[model samples]
Target: MKTTAKILNGLLILFLLVSCEKDELESTDPNLLNSANSEASENFNNGMIKSYSSDVVIQWNELLSQSIDNRLPQPAEVKIYVMVTLAMHDALNNVVPKYETYALDNSEVDASDITKKNIHTIADAAVSKAARDMMAQVFPPSTATADALLNSILSNIEDSDLKTRGIAIGQEATAAILQKRSGDFPLAFAGYPLYTEPGEYRSDFMPWAMANPPVWPANAVYAPNLGSLTPFGIESGDQFRDQAPFPLNSADYIKDYNEVKMLGCTSCPARTEEQTEIGAFYIENTSSFNNRVARALIVQKKLDGWEAARLIGLIEMSQMDSYIASFDGKYHFNLWRPITAVRLGDSDGIDETTGDASWTPTFTTPPTPEYPSTHSYNGGAAAAVFRAYFNTDHCDLDLISPYNLPGTTRHLSSFSQMARDNALSRIYIGYHFRNAIVVGERQGGELGKYVFENNLREIKKLK
Candidate 1:
């Protein structure tokens, strides 16, 4: 029965791939299998074929982003990406001998004694298998899509032994990562309570403002339980947590309120066309934007499989830790969003804060407690990691929005430039105050610094 089920599952997966890949199948690119051309190519497939490790990472990252966007929260999206990418890194590391393994949860597989194997074939099989299995666990409904990718990856390997070993290694890595993530952690979305006082996050707002689905529970003293998850390199989720938002009714608070009110409204005349473009470009969710930029940088540098693997692993782990730290601050303070403050300005006890009852944001407000914007945090985290990796803030990097423009790439002079723009973008879209973006950048920078200095560093290893 098990064998028959396997056969039937394989057939179903094939049918789904054919149905979904009508256009992709039309491309007759044979070089897809041997796409890498680095110093590492000399040792690949008995010196006959090159490895495509970086391409594998890019493809899998794109697929995973699409799958998670279909159904999952930000926390889960971060978690699954970390797992699948780390598995790919560890699997390739065993063959390349460049860095120390991340030491996944239940991983006990050993390949030290194996010899005369194709690292390219092994990497391809391992990455696809690890991604397929992990996605099955996180998004069971996405099995058809996941299986199609797996079939496509495996069908390209010509060597039987390399393919078999690659599958085995990938499976072992997935098990280890799953074991590491197993335990009590906050993975579900449940509501808490709302603060109904005059100055707090107002659950009761005008019909238009509150029409879209509430971030659920309307208002919770504590946000989602992201703090419960394990940190990558930080000692705790609150390790980088900072002070609360500016004191309500302070001069600083009044200045920030007026700035956002003038520039961040749906009908603000002060906002420029360039500012509006920046806002729209960054409107993409964190996972998609960060991953897309990271992939573009990796390809531009022509990093080999193991080099790309290690860089991607570090980037994702820092991002995950930064998010945890940001959420800790968000729930601890439970600050109101700009929309809430703008609508309730009259009651905030500030002489300068005149209430605008009919005010709307330039874009829809995200469903979460305000203060210490996660988008800003994500930007800072990614920038810091890139800066650390290149050993300079002056590296040339450009990010084009997948959602906003297909041909227009925004040229960033430095990683810091990108970070600063991302921090300020919330105001352009009327989603965050200046204080939240500023503090979120600090928290994320600290998290990124900690991860960069402490973990996934290069070590002396024999090839």
Candidate 2:
């Protein structure tokens, strides 16, 4: 009886071991389990989907930079960036339903035909096509380059149904965004009338000693119609318009006037060497510099295609809206720049301030109305997006300004630090007053937060 019992017990133990192994095998088997039902299957699905590199985004952004380099106005540059990135993001999500589409509905992307085996290839094709189409449309001069990039990307994928479907999806997304943004571009400038009142904006025709003539003719106002362009993510351009600037004779105005007069002159003895460097370092194109920083972070974080598209889209959209908001306030308030304010100080009915007609700024001022600094607004918006995307303020960034302090690298420890430096730089360069910098940065921060919290949110899966 004892021998029989031992035999049965050994058989039961063997049966239990075989059953456990079968369970483990079944749990990992993709054919037998759904990705949502099994952790192993979920990981396997993710691995397959995220296997591809997001260099497509980087490549397209580079193409955008090349196409827009000194060729288009700032508002037009912002608009082009927004359109390209939005197309990329929307196309990728259509292929893989990872994020909410900005321009298309769920019915627009027929993901029912997509499978895990071809998801990444299809996604890559879609993104490449969308970027190519948008770039070609916005910048016809770069069509050949954009075409080459798309062909190079598609070469990796075999000519199959997946590729064709991806192209269709991409074309659809591009069309949707283009249709959505139709009539949003700035109108032709009709010439702004010069206002002679103190504290009002008027074009300064003062010529300066420089190697090259300015991009715009002397006394020409830059992008006066920019304020009328429609925003991407914000409700309206003037939704966050700042309050009126300080009165010309107020104590606040007097203090800021004196501060810029001392620290912001072309050869101010009060300005420190480091402050001069800071002033010069941030003089590059705002869109270009911010995108460069963003691309670096994308590489450093090793983000996949979806993550990179989403991040770039958010950053660009935030910047576009911020520019719109800033410009709206700019044209609405029509405040005079520091150069005009300082030169006409004595005539402004102010007792304490003195006018110096011979005064010059460290850098030539932008030709827009200057109550709030648009550059500072861009800095604040970009920094907010960076911090929100990383969920932290701290990031190691090494930046160089080829436009100003060429070959000199500046290292920043956090996004907020960068924003602060950028805002203060406007003051040092004598382009903006402290109040303008402060208000612009604050408005940008608010807009950035609103956009990140609201747009392109992740599509949460049902349990």
Best lDDT goes to which candidate?
2
Off by over 4 Å in 1: 1-53, 69-72, 105-117, 184-186, 206-223, 404-408, 461-463
Residue 224's lDDT in candidate 1: 63
Candidate 2 C-alpha lDDT tens digits along 1-463: 9999999999999999999999988778675566446555445545655775678778888888787854566767777888898999998888866678899664344555555677767887888899999999987888999999899889988999899988988998899999988877553323456688988986743332122334444456767767677778888888888588898878898899899988898998999999999998887767777878888898999988888888999998998888888988898898988888888888888888898887789988877788788988988999889988899999997887766667899998999999999999988988888999999999899988888888888765433
Instruction: Kindly report which residue pairs in candidate 2 clash with one another.
Output: none
Native-to-model Cα distance after best TM-score fit, residue 221 in candidate 2, in Å: 2.2
Whole-model lDDT, model 2? 0.82
lDDT of model 2, residue 55:
83
Counting clashing residue pairs in each candidate, in order, gives 2, 0
Give the Å error, residue 379, model 1: 0.7
Q: What TM-score goes with each of the models?
A: 0.81, 0.86
lDDT of 1 by residue, 1-463 (tens): 9999999999999998987797575563646534434244434422321245478867877787777742556666777777777887777655444566775422244444334445667778877887788778766776798899889889888867767878877787778777776773756544455576644554444222333244334332223678756787678878877587888768888889999999898889999988888887777766556776677778888876667777888888887887788877777777888888988899877779998988899876755677689989888888888889888898666666656655567888898988888888899988888988998887788788778777766543222
Alpha-carbon deviation at 191 in model 1, angstroms: 2.6
Model 2 lDDT, residue 391, Cα? 97
